[model samples]
Target chain A: MTADTTYKVPTMAEMAANGEEPEVLFWVGCAGSFDDRYKKVTVAFVKILNQVGVKFAVLGTEESCTGDPARRAGNEFLFQMQAVGNIQVLNGYGVKKIVTACPHCFNTLKNEYPELGGQYEVIHHSQFLQQLIDAGKITLKGGGTFKGRRITFHDSCYLGRANKVYEAPREVLQTLDADLVEMKRCRTKGLCCGAGGAQYFKEPEPGRKDINVERTEEALATGADTIAVACPFCMTMMTDGVKNKDREDSVKVYDLAELVAQAYSL
Target chain B: MVFFEQILFVLALAAAGWFLTRRIGLIRRAILLGRPEDRSDHPGERLNIMLRVAFGQKKMMTKPLVGLMHFVIYLGFIIINIEVLEIILDGIFGTHRLFAPYLGGVYPFIINTFEILALGVLLVCVGFLARRYVAKVARFQPERHREMGRWPRTDATLILVFEILLMTAFLTWNASDSLLRERGFGHYGELRGTVGSFVVSRFIEPLLSGLGDPGLVAVERFTWWFHILGILGFAVYLTYSKHLHIGLAFPNTYYSDLRPKGQIKNMPEITKEVQLALGIPGADPTEPPAEPGRFGAKDVRDLSWKNLMDAYSCTECGRCTAACPANLTGKKLSPRKIMMDTRDRLEDLQRGWQKTGPDFDDGKSLLGDYITAEEINACTTCQACVQECPVNINPLDIIQQLRRYRIMEEAQAPGSWNAMFSNIENNMAPWKFSPSDRFNWADQLKQ
Candidate 1:
């Protein structure tokens, strides 16, 4: 299993090998840059795209914050500035469509930027990954009947609620064949991990429940030995929540990238 | 003389009523709980908001029953103040029988009923206080020191002591009135006839017999004033205190927003043609019909008069942030902050207007220096905060206004933003896949 998975948007053939840059650009969001390892998944993402033969290009570090923080802070000016700047970069690249490993970035770029004049065809990496899986380009290693354990999945607010992305991850998990139990508060009503909205930077305070930890407790109640995460943001927060609950030995956090990459095990 | 008492009571109440109504109106407006605009835009949202936002309830069928129960008890407060109007009239005049006729002839029953209810509510409040202070439920952190969690013990003591004082006043009024009516001046003798009669027959009767004194009549006369005076003091104490809402809630609820759901009122539109003809702030000020770019709620005076009313009408319920998906998700955007900002701005304007100096035009606009772009974009536009707001102030309107100023007027949107906006502006779609591609995913015959 690859320890470092960079869940980039484009396949290596499109990014490096193929030399055929499509109209679409992949936005590797900030959190994905810092924590998402198992870069093999990006390779897998590339593998799926190559098999499916979709046209796309990779844009790393070229994209920045979609000014989500600024918008929440009541500073539309800075958000607009961010939106305009990002649009210029994307337009300069002659990019028309995009995909991403990060849901938050995808949500902002896809849903909000049009208001500021930056609009592109944006989608989550899970969509492409699922498409590749459906085509039988590559079968998942963890696919089919993982026993001796029960696991729950935490659907991120951004992916689940904001972007309405629920099916792709669940489908990925079902392929793993692990015993999947749902967190009571899953899907649209899924609680937050107290890490979004740039809250990871601030100190935890009273009355502010750690949505991740609270969610973790719910997962733990299901007697799950592992918690699968779809979004990289959910990955990092859930990792900490598992540790905080001292369930490191009992329960564990797995990035969908890492989990999917495991399916490629020889 | 008897008619003078009733008329004097009525006039004094009328005066208090004016200021009271004004306060209620201002708060309701500021909270933005006005009736719906189109009335049909969002039925589901309206239902959920009414159930969750207004009642501080949630869809428990989806969430955990435990959490749901906690919130209900946390939110469902039964306010028992049947003596509200009577209390006010009693304060206005030096009368103790305030609305005594309306309640049955049982004085002890009336006093004991509210006293019991207040105690029960206090018990519930204590549980909430304990949950906040002791158990430290997630999302219970107090943003300010003077808030509930700061000095939990002291705050609890103060509230409990204050409630005790109210109960104590009733107790004293009952005891003293009983003594005076035994000497025969009280109109209602419910409590006095029971407890006081017993005490008077045993203790007071024997004492009077021993004195054989006509001066005992003077003592009873003094006792009657003390009974009326005690209730009067409670009245004045309540009106000037936080407990004032005990008298204000019904009026506040009645004047609440009864409009159609989810529709924000389109702000005042001025004759834009004149402003287009001759630009002042460089464009048509839409409300005043000036230049096009003249926005940011215009002058401090341009702020909705309803917003001004919110400050006085604030119930200090923190439900706005509680239901705020952003706040719960860890964003710094406090729905309460906007309300507080409006209040601070109004305070500043009030002081500035009083100044015998130059009228400041560019200190801090709500859409300008005070708030930032980061805060605005972070919002998921979930409307949880808006729905959760008991008073119904629309922060979304303010956010959209700020967004309008930034994108349309300032021309400061980012690169990705322009990529997104230009695509939509030119193609009328979020993506550049072309209009025909929309049908590529659609198959009419498949259904």
Candidate 2:
């Protein structure tokens, strides 16, 4: 668990050898591996993929960081190392494509990695689920046919700004029978969920606006009953923000995967 | 009285001629302003206030000592021109003799005082040049990523020579006038004799008398014509050259905005008809009448005259260049080049536009290739360029507009964007996660 002198982030070669190919190389990312709450979603998502006969695999445990942090700090050299290392690992495993539940991993792999020669079929979990739905995949059983369960979506900056991925999640909301409300700064100008640039693991700048709380307040102002998020980072930050506002009972957070699971009565 | 009157008439005619030419071109350049509408989501109703920053040097003043130094030298050149007029009048009216052709007067002392001020101004210019070339403040360095080349060093050099010469002439005239005051009639002053006093101590008494010939008057007259005319000519040339920063200071300062820092402007749609009507769309900085105006800057001509003028006003200071994150992070984007590109292409555009009719546009296409989505998207929107811009041209707004055009209109984007966008519509997150248990974290976090 600790980075030793011999610390090496997991390699795709080792992942392939261990038969960790889980259809989508669902990169749990660093925060997922470290946070107990995030680890549960990854576990549950994996279990569902298994139940549905969706073949998949795990990656090298060394998938610790995406180096998005270093790049933003003007340290391009470190960014390149992480980029090359990950690409090499993925290439060694013959990973022609990857599916990630982490928005940071999704953005990094989908947008940034190509600069360092890492190119592949990459998808965020929401898009993958939507594809599965379109293919007449397992239909989720609606619990109480939860209609009018108004939920506002938080756009992670990387998912929105870095890649401009805006609408797929909304389509998921449409299918799940959840009423969708959008924040004022949705889509390309979408506000950050306050957990990016590897900020998921560190304290933000003091005296700076907490974008997550600001976004959560914006969502709350819309009178939405619940907040749905596709990224675990958004889920964590939104959950905390909701609690801090004492809106725990009035509003709540949900992961897209967990929502899909409940609808299918998994 | 008749002779004095004739001299005043001649001087008035020349000054009027120079003033007229200066006014026309500067007015035309300023009036032919363009504001490109490519990058923003502006409210379109708020004050531009950006102008205040450009004219105020407020942002530059953040680096206070450096800002104050440029301000002093900039204002000094402006004030000395009044003194220059006094010299020209003195020449024309034939007080033509400095210190009145009669020696030992209070007039010589006043003449000597102005010379000292000119020297003081010249020293300030020296300091600014050193800060840019030698001290190499990050703000003053080229914002090159791999260092393909450097900024044009010529602009700095010319301004220096121009100031030094003016100072030299003033000192020469002063020293010569002083000695002539000490000697007696027929002793005329020029630059060499002004400084020649220093050498006068070493020279024989014969040399001082030798310097007093009518030839010394010719010497004074010759250096006076060249130095004064040279500075004046440089002033006129700067109105059209990259050294236009000289002309840019006051107007640029007067128009600068003092509003919120780097605030985003909300944009409105510009209609196609407006382009046809105005002959260019998306270039007006002010609001269009209630109608769909230009959606975005269709070409460079569609830029506002202010935006176009912003190009000429640059001193090639490299402040914006040093601050661009994309440039720093090794992306092919430099804010400085964007401004420089604006100025460089103007001539070619003018050549083409002039030869053609009113719709005579050289096409804003030059910037099209240079400010591509790749370069635009690479920017982190960090406001470094905005913060570092010596004249406060917000490259961030331009980059964003270019990006919007690339995304919304051209549909040109990176391959990964397709997958990312699909996920947003499909899974409600960029990640294709299952929707059934999005809240499962609630149960697991009990520990």
Candidate 3:
């Protein structure tokens, strides 16, 4: 459950150097790499993969942006310029399956990459974790850490509407034995945290209120102690909303992987 | 006196033809003002899409009640136009019920069928009018949507009211002519078959019964003139109204994006540039080292012809905005507004060209003057708008084009976006960090 000197994590480059291939490539997205908060989610997911003995390797230095922001921001040229580079890297490695915690990356890789001839079995972490749970490869101890806790899962736009992975996150939540309350707008009709379409990087246009603030108010209305998220963007936006509402101390935002990790005390 | 009537009919026909042709020509020119795109591939798929979405009304069927009403209106519009053709021929030749003699018994049947359709059209138009004004369907009211305000509401109401008047005129013409026949007036008796089973006219017979031959003739002539002129006027006015969708739906559905809704198109030009930069094998070389051109669309000219076609094809139904998650979440973005803004800007551009030639620089564009960065940015790119569009119009395409112009051309993206852009350019990711540290998250699993 903790980092030790003798433990080793392999990179795709290192695995290829040793004439080997992992079962899947763990795409540590930008936030997973550098964002302090999302890094914990990334580490938790990695620990689960390690515990389940799923052989996964990081692309490390070879990995690049999927160009989701570039494309969404309307810089198709930059996006393609970025996508083509990443596609070359993935194709060069003959990567067959990819797992990522970010829905944006999952969407771009699963949907957009195929057009540029970089096709692979791309699965979101929530879905992959569900698969692990289904296969009985990972088990929760007793009722799990979220047992009887009032938790509301926020549907990330990319994961929910863009990709239609509504059930997987909910299924993962079900395994926690938590009181999974839902906001008024959930699933297909879920309100966005106003972070999609590269909006996270921009100040909102002169609207009466920010979209995240509106969405956060809805999540808070659920009266759930925990606001569970599956995407880093949603996490950041929801966390900010909670702080703005002065409910940061009362309502905590945890990535799905964070809950799963906490259940195992990893 | 007969000769004068004949000349007036001829002149009216000529005027209608001239104006309709001019309006259509303007639309063609405006559509062509956009950059060329090759949507010529997949003939079979395009045809199938046209038949299913536009002709079959597949998308509209999702809301069965509204869908049924729309189907009735659509069917009436198409089937009733047959009578318009008959009117056109009769108007030109100055013949009374010209088609009636050609097919003796079938003439009555045809008229009866036309009457039924005209009645349907009337009812449906009334229902739509009530939905807009009486019940005030939230989507139809301009007050609920700033983009749709007064002019759009008036435009919609005017068209519906126009249809009601046109149908009334036709039915009145029928009733008065039948009355003339009953009175044994000149040529009215011998001109048409039976006139026996006039469904709508039979009910209207009481109103026209009091008018003698001269009075009947006057009523017939007035209704006749109003009906024909209304048809002509409607045709001309459609080019300026959301009703242009009647003419545009077929082509818009045909050219609609057949790709999976989830797939965002990649720029092939940029792909080639990146390939050469990455030193990929067999990549095209000596193609003039890629210099960045306009990164995204700035004006109507920068958008593809299909996008411009979509603008023209928009029905202003607000279905897209109604389904939009951004709009539902109270964001400023509305897919309907995007199409409206695009169409309005394109019209402005067309007018500018007409006034000052193609080289005229009004210094305004589809981006800032019409659509704003805030609206475009608020989109979740959920494709709810695209999915809900009955005619297959894609507002996301326009939004993306405008966003591209903002980021790539104007460099007007927010500071945080600029930082992310720099991060991607330098570190090959959206985070400002070294690639060597990417696997550090996995190190936490060490035991």
Candidate 4:
């Protein structure tokens, strides 16, 4: 479904040229920008922002990777090179707040950037969505699509144990009125989807089973038909995991943004 | 003569003290061999964390049953050691139950509580041994964790067996002492008779009932000697065993990383180089750059002091390895093994330093010789291991440093990683997509 012609995504450059400033700069991370599946999440999050009448601008082409993968993979030189470049562009825009759908970017920008003179009030979109919901700015229909449906959220390590945003996403999901079944391992004990630490870039070292597959088994054991994820990396891993188990037809993996967008019919 | 006995006790005390002090000094030196980073900030917060995690055994309670058993042993071990104070004073001053006159009613109560805790410690130690050997808990199994090889396995069993023997000696001594007191044998009868039979040890009194008054006195004295000597021996052996956690856990938890688990420490040295290359406004173009230090940890010495301390603090519980996503999926990396290898390499260096000099090189390093590239690569940096550790050890820090070393210094990263790195460098993303087309996903909105 295409949006009306009135809907236009404002770029930071365009906003600067027009002498306008949005409330928050939406950081469409590498996956949110380039990954075909994760692009939908970016679109869904944008739709939610528009529906809620929240003024937001995207960096578009000016935004670069936050160097999370490089730093995690131990290429500190390359990581810092990317970090400084991104920070300069961010500082150039005078961006004061950032919200992102990617946990990796959220973590790096919120925690790692301040040390190198790049600091802002950065937050994961899950936390942002929870705030909106709590503020009563966004409301779901009485009989939303996810009502009573079994949904198990796969905790993103960067967001959960890393930053302790375990409840924000779950709280957002609770607004859908869906049955949130918990995996045996949840919260601090939650299993990784195996794509973290740049493991997504390379094949896993030979092992009996993939880490994502093991995590998927736990998710499936909860018997939830819908698996929810907060991070783009977890989305790729868990989606691939479902396809690997030949349960793609039965189980669907959706980002929290996508679920919220769909639930509200944005 | 009592004089000779006193002299012997003093000699044993001096020897134990000397050996423990020497070993502790060596450990401190070895840990200091690592590069320094300040973990001394927020003393109040660190104290709170140490109190909760180490003293309160907070994280261990994640597995309630096992945590309770561990709490029993820990509480029993600490409380029962109070009795040793009396033993030591009695040994040096040639006094039998010296506190009995002053303590009066409280003496029997304290002894009764000690007896109960002693029984708890004995039972829990046996249960722990059974969990390791009989039930074959997955975490403790050498078959599951190759790092639990013969010596590590033997080290654990040896401590358990040692504690069991010590507790047995204590109870048998108490039982025999009560019997001798009833017979008013020599010095045993000198007490105000206020310290009655201990609660739990009374059960053992039946076995010693068949002995004569002289035999009972000898049994009491021998077991007393055995119990005290065993404790002194255990203290020295602690420095050499994984049981060092009994002492190191306090400091390790106190200095734990207080930042978010996901926040990997940034390298200021690297940041300077990056700033200079980018010609950032604040970077001094005319000034000469600082000499480059090693990028990451190539050996134990290259790691931080906290990382080295984590190795010594590790109890070899295998909880980290058990929680590791890589190890759970059969990958080669085990967080427990990483800590074990670090400690082993440090010890190797310590021995070499003692034999030759501080500058002596062994032609081996922790990265290549102990922990292999494959093991560190398999880590997902999930922080599950760090979260699972009861003592707040961060194995992820060491793994990340080693990864940094492998990639930056050795340039030994796998082909795909190199490709990804180059892609991120040229394309501004991990994949080979053009940055110009970043907004393509938004085209649908305009349509």
Docking class of 3: acceptable
The DockQ-based CAPRI class assigned to model 1 is incorrect
Give the TM-score of each candidate.
Answer: 0.52, 0.52, 0.86, 0.99
User: What is the C-alpha local distance difference test score of each model?
Assistant: 0.52, 0.57, 0.84, 0.92
Candidate 3 - chain A - TM: 0.97
Docking class of 4: high
The parts of candidate 2 lying over 4 Å away from their true place are: A1-266, B1-58, B91-113, B129-151, B186-210, B257-259, B270-294, B354-364, B421-447
- Taken in order, the candidates have interface RMSDs of 12.3, 16.9, 2.4, 0.8
Ranking by DockQ: 4, 3, 1, 2
The best candidate in terms of DockQ:
4
Residue B35 deviation, candidate 1, in Å?
Answer: 18
Candidate 3 local Cα displacement, residue A172, angstroms? 6.3
Task: Pull out the clashing pairs in model 3.
Answer: A74-B404
Candidate 1: stretches off by over 4 Å: A1-101, A109-145, A149-155, A160-227, A233-253, A257-266, B1-8, B21-48, B56-116, B125-164, B167-186, B189-342, B351-447
Q: What DockQ does candidate 3 score?
A: 0.45
- Per-residue lDDT tens digits of candidate 1, residues A221-254? 8888878876665776777888888888877787
The candidate, 3 or 4, that scores higher on TM-score is 4
Candidate 4, residue A259: lDDT: 93
Better of 2 and 4 by DockQ: 4
Error of 3 at A21 (Å): 2.2
